[model samples]
Target: MTVAGWETRKNVPLVGHQVLLQYRKGTSGAFVTPKKVRTDRDGWATATVKATADGAYRYDFAGTSLTRATTGSADFVDVK
Candidate 1:
């Protein structure tokens, strides 16, 4: 699913908002090193991952503050 864009609710300009995505085997397992991403002009970004085999995959999207994450298993097979 595509994430909605975020708007800075602060009174000042929000610069350098960093984003990280972590994927792991399970909820109790260690979080894998996430690829660095930045919010677009509309504070939104997307990542397309392919599954090597049939298994469970979980992802987390974090920024300097709280942000939404994507989850579910639907057989990821391509980047596009």
Candidate 2:
């Protein structure tokens, strides 16, 4: 599965934010350390992963107090 077109809250645009991708293996409730990436003007972000490390994954968009923005989360699959 591929995840695309993720965005931030519509109320606020141009808010500094970051996207984190985390995954676990085989129905496990555990999520590993996430990879961080910046977002675009459309609030869209992307995260790529291989099925080799397949599992339930969570997308976290957190605010940066330093940047004074909010955070959000989404879920998707990464086909290897």
Candidate 3:
């Protein structure tokens, strides 16, 4: 899966930082593990995930830098 998100500060892109992705399966309260994706110059980060069994997966992002810190989440990713 290609995961993309924007890192910004005060309405401007925050570049050259690492965004962490944590994921879990349906109804699971704990995330398996975390992965890191680096943002581009425009503050966009992408992560390519490997294939998995068809099920509902949830994910979230956390990014931290010298100047900023942020977090976000999304609905389950349904793979049929």
Best by lDDT: 2
The local lDDT score (0 to 100) that residue 48 gets in candidate 1 is: 52
lDDT of 2 by residue, 1-80 (tens): 11232474334443335667777776656777467766666566677666675467666655454343333443544557
- Superposing every Cα of model 1 onto the true structure, what RMSD results? 6.9
Q: After aligning candidate 2 to the native by TM-score, how far in Å is the CA of 23 from where it should be?
A: 0.4
- CA RMSD per model (angstroms): 6.9, 7.7, 6.3
Per candidate, the number of residue pairs that clash is 0, 1, 0
The model with the greater TM-score, 2 or 3, is 3
Alpha-carbon deviation at 63 in model 2, angstroms: 2.8
TM-score, per-candidate, Cα-based: 0.44, 0.56, 0.59
Worst 10 residues of 1 by lDDT: 71-80
Mark the 10 consecutive residues where model 2 has the least summed lDDT: 1-10
Q: Tens-digit lDDT track for model 3 on 1-80? A: 12233453335556766676666666566665456776777767777676364333333445343343445654466666
Q: Write the per-residue lDDT of candidate 1 for residues 1-80, one digit (tens) a residue.
A: 23333564443332345545545543345556446556555555455555553334443444334435443332222322
